[model samples]
Target: MIASSARLARAAGGSRNWLLGVLRGSSYGTASEASFQVESYKLHKLEQGPSTSVTLSRDDGLKMYRQMQTVRRMETMAGNLYKSKIIRGFCHLYSGQEAVCVGMENAMTPDDSVITAYRAHGWTFMRGVSVQGVLSELTGRVSGCAKGKGGSMHMYGHNFYGGNGIVGAQVPLGAGIAFASKYRGEEAICVTLYGDGAANQGQLYETFNMAKLWNLPCIFVCENNGYGMGTSVDRASASTAYYTRGDYVPGLWIDGMDVLAMREGTRFAKDYALKNGPILIEAVTYRYSGHSMSDPGTSYRPRSEIQEVREKRDPITNFRERLLSSGLATEEELKKIDTEVRKEVETAAEKAKTDQELPLEELYNNIYVDPPQGMKIRGCDPTIMASTR
Candidate 1:
């Protein structure tokens, strides 16, 4: 390039020619550097951790961007479905927390298991459950992961424990799973997730002690999504450092909005837990929607807060920017991905609408492994009890 510039300068008789040479060589783009050049994007509010190397190659960047977009689109559709009365019971949309689930899932191996509390739509999708099944579950259709039984709070998959409803209840169950994995001499690590609200529960600390004592391979993920239901973390908890909530257990705090960072943090935690027992991850993230369908998300928090996060820290947008900056993809390509994801989610919803709801007998059968002669439980309607005689 320099030699060519010199020859052009001589041919054009000086500075005017040199300027032309430079202008011709440089492409008009946001970044002056080569499109494929890797750039450093800083992690936000990472309070603590031993850092891990992240190579956001073109394939990885685009893939993660696509996954996060899918989760966001899925949650948006779920919210719409809920407002339309298609999704009944309690429904918690995991819109802004897409990075946490997608990153964690990416870091997980086939043997690694996962269990989280109610906000579990994204996790269920990542665990090999089809989008159709997830939507069907939300729509209370039999095609759901649990055949319409679990709904949003109880979908299950291979090596995935559940969408447990009770607060902090899944923690010990996760420990039990890790223990079982150890007993079988399997190298599986269990990732147990709960919210900041559940962080204050005594059961979590109890499980932490047992897990540390037994040296179980467990990654206790505290998804600190700013609020515990209607109350902010500061309003609810005495201390907000969820990572350190498990006293003796080592903890790492990461910017949960960054998918690459989340993936690296989870990977480290999983590896550390396998040999050194339990570790905790306080993934600082935010949720775009209300705690559930019952709560209007804007009451406790200002709408501006959500808007700011959406504009500035949106995981999907941030990842997309990285891809564009690195020349991994053009703006058109990313938009195309978004367009495809939105359509895919919409199609799943359409298909889910046609699924058959579980019959009333299903209520009585799943409750007991062996149905007694006089088994009776509340059917589809609580006012009318159905008998399994």
Candidate 2:
């Protein structure tokens, strides 16, 4: 009886040990595994509640609010124009990602240069292009910043380079701009914006190496909106942490939905680049529109997913809430700004729709600084050229 009781007790103890081992798995087998689990839990908590407070003055807050509103309204108007067939040829609206551009613009100096991909209406607006000019560009009118030549994907303004179409192509051009700024010894920085899809290109790393080697004053920003066209970042990129792409260059990751967070983060990056050469910043934002107007935006992502980001993580709405909570703005003040922006956008759209287009003769005029003396231009009836001349 004594032997039987001792054997039973031993069996029960072994069973308990086996259960504990199953519950713990590899977590308790090694110190490193335990430490990793704890670190991951802490990071998850940080993501849930990011530190997003800012100390902007009332005026600055109001200005940022207005800037964000302008971007939203402008993109909305562009969408309408595209539907009505007023704007033609590849219209990409920057509706949901306004905060990344507006907040970064607020932190930049007038002399600083900015460049981005085809989804560029927001940055152009933030870079001092008027609503009328943007709309006119979309409509291909004579009053466009590109003089009715380059359409939506090629608009430009003072100190703004371009709305490049080629993916990952703008990095080297932006580096050249930075090189020029450094060569001239100007207190200016170049901000190069690209999508997560473009992050996988070979040239991006080459640009990074060159930028770091020469210590160019360039801030390479990756707007990781989670999707590269239809492919999710996870599918397209092996490493989704784009801020660390610079490797040698210091990196920053910010909640792109928070205007203040983006503003502060961009300011820090700009200052760092100015003082210590180059830096990389990754803004984790989302795009509400399809990759282009042709897409329905439903193949890879669901409507509910898009709606959640719009409702809860919209940069414009988020900014308004923060401003009101901090006493930086009142509902009445916000409403007044909204009313003015609506009027401005409406007027610009009307002008864009009615504006005159560039004449055919002007098409080949700006291709070169001076036309070649004896160039046989194809499709040019000699009679027509002579008549025009």
Candidate 3:
């Protein structure tokens, strides 16, 4: 009977350990910094480009992994919320394109400016906005970064210009920000991003010409995600080589699926732009979800193609494997990080869902940085005026 009791006790102990493993995740050991070679970059109008070698410390690797995971999870949650009708209006999901923002932000400083098109949620988060802030903005909650006014497309952070809703409109504005940095005698550079869809805009060419003429320290990025909305890039663009489209401006075609590559290429681009003038970078990424919530994303492209890219070229998964293979992180450690990120996103999402909307009186409050006492702003009806006091 004593032996039977001993066996039962051991079994119970084993079960408890298993449960603990499930919750806390096991750690193998502390990972150290290491250098690994990344893919070579495709250059445009340049003699050379960024080095392929990249150094990865444990801290940076873990941070990048956690960030990419957080964005992915947050986007997934946003999609769910949108589907449930909790988030109204246009909602763009940045699932497969996590590496672009994460990688570029890692290479940039807080003083550097960024502006992008309507697909700005991930960029907003990378620019230092919290998950709750992004979700709340999507939910139109009072606690959002924009006081729930900007919604999905117009969220902003410090030195990080808000996403512009108009296609290709932000490029010229980004140049202006770069011009401001130069004017102020600051070392800051502006990173302006737009999608492949906006590549054909005439305003872009005009902006490019002016930026080159002024030698503006701006990095114009084209996030070529294969398709422009439901239409394939090939069908829409006369020249699919977006990086080389900027004839006078130097460009780099980066593997947007590789975060490390993105970082290195961006680092090079920033330095080159600071020294020379405006440059272009085509981040050849893929979007897993539809253009907005409205697009199925698979109608034009085959579902098999999307699945293939997810399985083969997914940025998060590829980076995870790179970390493990480089001995930068163990599976257990990554799992633990994943658990934390998932919980953080889930918690933020819950708060976003429950947060209150701004009071109607605040509609015209922020129209001006400083409004005169008893300032009145026109409402939807020209005859109606709203008090800004």
Candidate 4:
């Protein structure tokens, strides 16, 4: 009956009714307006913070929910393929941190830039790469965004730098990108994300200094996901209050698990960074999977703790409940979206699994954007000189 209603709605004209008239299944449509009480941003060295309350329209709610759900499902599929050994080498799943990327991306414009660490599947998708693109990249297929070469931690999108493999490498690179934007006098800002593990890197502090010195428009985000490579944040850093770690730069501590909170905080930070200089944001999130595909993620932390977070603070589930309670959506509507997401992800997974990888002759093809004419690059062995495609 629900499927029939969906088909009927689609057949009618694929309007808003396609989402509402059928999925709503009610005389009165879902609430047109809703206000949610998101967690307040904890400020440091700043006079004001983002509002504790945020207004949500059905459109925004549905989009945010769907994006987060797609990321979660896609990451799950990546994990499954990795376990089966199809996706080899350096597979990092961003399962429990969906809200961070989804919320941040929704607040960003295409003109804005983003760069982040290796756990970048979610960010890659948020930046416009499809699930198929990300999965195929992981599987080293010809159809990947990087054309099967970059692999898991090197995927790129427009205005998105990379899935940088080095622990603290992307931070300074992001600063440079912001500097370039300022140099060109473009009204753009760059959001550079790193994990709690990278918090202690000296290069980050050096980049922070340079960013502030030049007044570059950069938002440095630390996704403090409690544990870093099996070690707790407490063990990783002497001072875990990452927001305050940037002594001169202003900071905001945010509830990373809450999508609304993340959105508001990022929106606020983006504006502040453009007007003033760089700002620091510590998004306190959690990760359900191991640091990489190789670790089981159980020896260091208790399974019960993971269960607790899933039960009490799972981002997707919490957002779904909020949508229902606030009348932004109905259970049936959300369920329909979930069903569609699963099917989309499953279809993408199948293609990624079966897609063809780049052939051998194409090697060293993208060595340089504009290589000199007749440039023959060295191949695997010095004896083998390869011509540029």
Candidate 5:
């Protein structure tokens, strides 16, 4: 009877009745039949294979989930600190876009380098900089990754080049790193990340041409978070498809909020670049905080929009759900991780607040490896000679 009804509905121009009946039968019908239908759907999707979910192992999923959670909590702590005026200077938080860094870092080896714009706390954390080091940097203390000189916008770790201040300037630097890696005959690749706002910079194209001309092993990533500072990507660039900005580089666009998809896409890009030269990946992610903690974050965008993204598509929440559904992790386990991460962030912030600021004289210390001849020495300048002239 159900088959006859489905046939009649299909005969009627593939109407809604056919779709509804199919769904009903699949859900409320025989278990065996439902299983068969699911298998058929999976096979069909595999054959089509345009947009599909990327498979992830339980260990990979859990690791990505933990990294993302750590970033989320760390950003949340920074926002609170900024509110209290504990952390000052241009601070860009990467709260809503954890998966991009976590996934890409997972695809990279320890020797591979990464450089990004001011929105870099996430990358720093993923690159093995302790939360304490990042918080200390924000607080301008001696314990920071840059020893308090490079504040929130310039933290670095071993192999992680920088949190560059110039908008799209890191592209060429990343290319340079890649050039060095290739010169040394190393298999390492450099991943340079930039914002949608920086995508319009003419230098990016120059770097792209050079990278391609030399067949450099570099992965140029554009984190298309919709807005660059106060300007939406649409307003800033005629061509908003940032991945395609590098016309010479093959491009891949992944759902940035989906950890599995990000991991799979980044892995594919890294491998392809290793073999076929450079590649570009555009991860469509979002940032929840203001471009920095100073901006109210509502002047250019709607609160409703941020709320929608958070409630519906939060990367951490999405990954948590997938893990639970797949039995890779339990809700209790995830909650414990969340609690521990929050506590760790809070402790780091407290330590950062009390850590001593860099000495005023240290400012002139690292200016040069050795002082230039006849260079005017300033107060406490380490360049001052100890000899009696």
Candidate 6:
């Protein structure tokens, strides 16, 4: 049975099965010796990202496959919830950007911090929030992380800052978080991410200036999905090279669709930030859906264009093929993983439906830091009144 193999992969072979062992739970790690290697990589103006033969063990490969599928399934469920009038207001799906999150999260230690723009369900799950927690939050359930208050743009956690609503606002907050880590003498670095749309925001430049001056351990990430809302990257910005925006900070550009490349890019950037101040990375990713729930996502770009990318570079399919071809996992093993992930998502959705929606007065709590991790409400509510909690 595939389940038996998964169990064996985790239980048998001890240290040799390090990554597989870790895969039994929420965490994962890469082997010291790569079971496979990344043949190529993407970089900024220069090739600063990992171009060497980096090891990617079978266990690690399976872990990434599961992670990407989980995110995709979660986002798919979110979209359905939005259509059914459950999740509302400013819902941005990260269905196509799984590799970036999975790769980047796997490359770092638990101490590292991350902050991103509104598209954050994947990152929230990667940072340890459960499918139930994420779905409950989006559904405005009392059990939701942020207690059903933060909704789509305000999820937060231990080392994860938030699903910031402002376009480029999280960039400065990320720098501040890195500054705090540095002030406390912690070795953690902060990864702040924005989309190609927010790449040109004036505050982002200001954050870059301050981060460079203070040598803050911040990794500024530009998830350049080639479109800012409905506008193409070239038309939206004078220069589409987001990595070079941080003139003083060193930069790397990489293929965001490839999870392995993402892992190498983040690993290299994390080390560069800890030792050499801040760094910049523009991950060339794509989003299969509209900018938000309201946008059809087909107005600006041709359907064929998006279809071509899906056919050629869909991150999940690409990684899945690599795993199969490389003999890292069997077809049945992968099917089991997909089945398991689907069941998890469906179970989470059903449970989310039963969760009690937060009351109007629940907003009074968590005005400030009186209590850590306040409640959140799904944006479906038609009205809200403020109170001190």
Instruction: List clash counts for every candidate, in order.
Output: 0, 0, 0, 0, 0, 15
Q: Is candidate 1 or candidate 3 better by lDDT?
A: 3
Which has the higher lDDT value, candidate number 2 or candidate number 4? Answer: 4
- Write one digit per residue (lDDT tens) for candidate 6, span 1-389: 11111221211112111222112122122222233344345454444467544556777888999999999999999999999998977799998899999999999988999999999999999998999889989988887888888898889777988899988999999999999999999999999999999998999999999999999999999999989999999898998888888887788877788787789878888888899789999888899999999999999999998887887778898677656544466788889999999999999999788888877755564454432333444432223223212
**Which of the predicted structures, 1 or 3, would earn the higher TM-score when compared with the native?**
3
Candidate 4 per-residue C-alpha lDDT over 1-389 given as tens digits, one digit per residue, 9 for 90 to 100:
11212221111111111212223323223666566666667788999999876766789999999999999999999999988999998999999899999999988899999999999999999999998899999999988889879888999999999999999999999999999999999989999999999999999999999999999999999999998899999888889999998888899998888898899898999999889999999998899999998899999999998987887778898777667755667788888999999999999989998999887867865666655656667543233333333
| Per-prediction TM-score to the true structure, in the order listed | 0.83, 0.83, 0.89, 0.90, 0.84, 0.85
lDDT of 5 by residue, 1-389 (tens): 23211211111111111211121122111211110010001111012211233445555666778889889888888888888898887889998899889978887889899999999999998999999999999889888888888988898998999899998999999999999999999998999999998898999999999999998999898898989889998788898777677886677776677565576677777777787788887888899878877678899999999997887677787566545544455677778878888889889998899999988877766655556665655553533543211
Residue 264, candidate 4: C-alpha displacement in angstroms: 0.4
Question: Which sections of candidate 2 miss by over 4 Å?
Answer: 1-53, 370-389
lDDT of 4 at 288: 95
lDDT of 5: 0.75
Cα lDDT of model 3 by residue, 292-383, tens digit: 99998878999998987887778898778667655567889999999999999999999999989987767765566545656666432222
Model 1, 1-389: lDDT tens digits are 21111111111111111111111122222222222211122222334454544554456667778888888888889899989998899999999899899888888887889999999999999888988889999998988888888899999999988899999999999999999999999988999999998888999989999998999999999999999888899999888877777878888877787787788778777878887888888888899889999988999999998998887777787666555544555788788898999899999999788878988666654655554555555542332334334
Question: TM-score of the candidate numbered 4?
Answer: 0.90
RMSD of 6: 8.5
The alpha-carbon lDDT assigned to residue 159 of candidate 5 equals 92
Residue pairs whose backbone atoms clash in candidate 4? none
| lDDT scores of the candidates, listed in order | 0.78, 0.77, 0.85, 0.85, 0.75, 0.81
State the displacement of the C-alpha of residue 101, model 6, in Å, after optimal TM-score superposition: 0.4
lDDT of 6: 0.81
Top candidate, metric TM-score: 4
Which residue pairs clash within candidate 2?
none
Flag regions of model 5 displaced more than 4 Å.
1-53, 370-389
lDDT of 3: 0.85
Which of the two, 4 or 5, has more TM-score?
Answer: 4
